[model samples]
Target: MTGWLVRDAVAGGLAGAIVGGAPSTLHALLTGRDPLAASYAAGRMVLPSEQRPARLLAAAVLAHGALSLGWAVPIAAATPPRRAALFGAAAGLAVAALDLGVVGRRIPAIRALPQGAQVADHVAYGVVVALVCARRRVRRG
Candidate 1:
């Protein structure tokens, strides 16, 4: 039970990293700062996964992180918390919509990161897979 929670938190945080990376990157870009340099500093939410044996579990974590990333900080970066929350959810939904658009479609040989995406698409899949499996376990229990 504890392990599952730990996994979720870590997955949540990694998702947080993805969530936080964008606006932080945007901040850096507009200011002519190096986005990579700020990646960890601003994107410190991702922690190492505790559930290594479960592949699908990890991938869901990635997707959750991606979903979280698409929503979280950027909305709150400059606006009021309430407004940020609304915008964050909107951003999350937009990203989710995009994911829905391409989730099963093959990318041929390579899945390139979009112009401002911080992490690669494949890596995100791995994390998301883990998260998904974890969720299934939670449901079963």
Candidate 2:
């Protein structure tokens, strides 16, 4: 269990960096910074999906969902009831964007695409990660 948590933390944090930092990369590139700067600056490897296998990806998924729960619950609790739903919605979208855009292999072209396409990509990442993590928990039996 201890080993799992440690691996999950590293995997998830790296995954989070990938997801959250994509925008930083885009921001850098749009402003004329080295495109590879984001890749090295964050201490993240940014490896290709083909290089990662099912279980490692599953660990990453679990880590992301755990991070999402940590963010969402607190925001919901802190916001006013009337505004809680909106807050949750925005948080969910932000999580999806971070996870999908950088961590789950979405490209910056999302900003160029239709809004629905962007939403779909992020939502897909969230949903798949949720499913993979759930399956992993069951498999640990």
Candidate 3:
């Protein structure tokens, strides 16, 4: 049981990071904006006044990965096998509400991001996590 939980968490976390980050990154590039803008913003949470881009990017990746892993546990555990996608999408929206709407309001950097992109990313994260968890369950059976 513990092993399954750990595997689910790790798999879901990786999937969330990839699926969640892609849209924003692509949007930034398409809009002629810095693709790393979101990463920088995430990094700012830890290194609030850091001016160096490299350090900031690194911090952002680490932070994002950590947060993804943290969120994956609950998402993986709670997602129902049936209609997992729908549940994931709803969960993602809820996560966005808390992470972006509530908590983000407190963080200037997070607040400054494009709301649409961030929300979309959160939704993607949720769906991917759910799908990953569901897929794992099917394979195990």
Candidate 4:
């Protein structure tokens, strides 16, 4: 059980870092914005916006991975692999509501971006994490 948990966390984290962060970063870059800066602004809850150095991109990526892993643990434990994708999408919606409805309203930096983009990014996160965790579970079984 402990090993499975660890595997899930590590897998989810890596998936979130790559599958989740890459799209948003690329989108921000293509739109003529600094990826790290955008990430800092959006994720001010984890890392402050003031420290928006390019070097901090690694930290931001790691933070996303960590948060993804944390979110994955309970979801993995609670849901079966067969329903992972659906549950993951629901999780994404919940995250979107919390972020846009609550965090964005409270945080000026985060509110600067379009709500739609954030929702898409969050859904991407959920789907990637769900797929990764499900794969891990299936492989183990």
Report each candidate's C-alpha RMSD, comma-separated, in the order given: 15.6, 12.1, 1.2, 2.8
Q: Determine the C-alpha RMSD for candidate 2 after optimal superposition of all C-alphas.
A: 12.1
Local accuracy by lDDT, each model: 0.40, 0.41, 0.89, 0.68
In model 3, the Cα lDDT at residue 128 comes to: 94
Candidate 1, 25: how far from true, in Å? 0.5
Local accuracy of candidate 4 as per-residue lDDT tens digits, 1-141: 588877786777567546765666677778887666546764565566546555455555566566667776765565467877787777767777876788677877667765666777777777777777888888878
TM-scores, each model vs. reference: 0.29, 0.32, 0.94, 0.76
Model 1, global lDDT = 0.40
Q: How do the residues 37-139 of candidate 3 rate in per-residue lDDT, one tens digit apiece?
A: 8999999888889979999999998889998999999998898989989999999999999989887888888898788888989989999999999999889
User: How far out, in Å, is residue 125 in model 4?
Assistant: 1.0
Ranking by TM-score: 3, 4, 2, 1
Best by TM-score: 3
Candidate 4 segments exceeding 4 Å error: 46-52, 55-62
**In model 2, what are the clashing residue pairs, if there are any?**
none
Off by over 4 Å in 1: 40-141
Candidate 1, which ten residues in sequence have the lowest lDDT sum?
A: 104-113
Each prediction's number of clashing residue pairs: 27, 0, 0, 0
Our tally of clashes for model 1 stands at 27
Alpha carbon lDDT at 101, candidate 4: 84
- Among residues 3 or more apart in sequence or in different chains, the pairs in candidate 3 whose N, CA or C atoms overlap within 3 Å are none
Output the lDDT of residue 53, model 1. Answer: 30
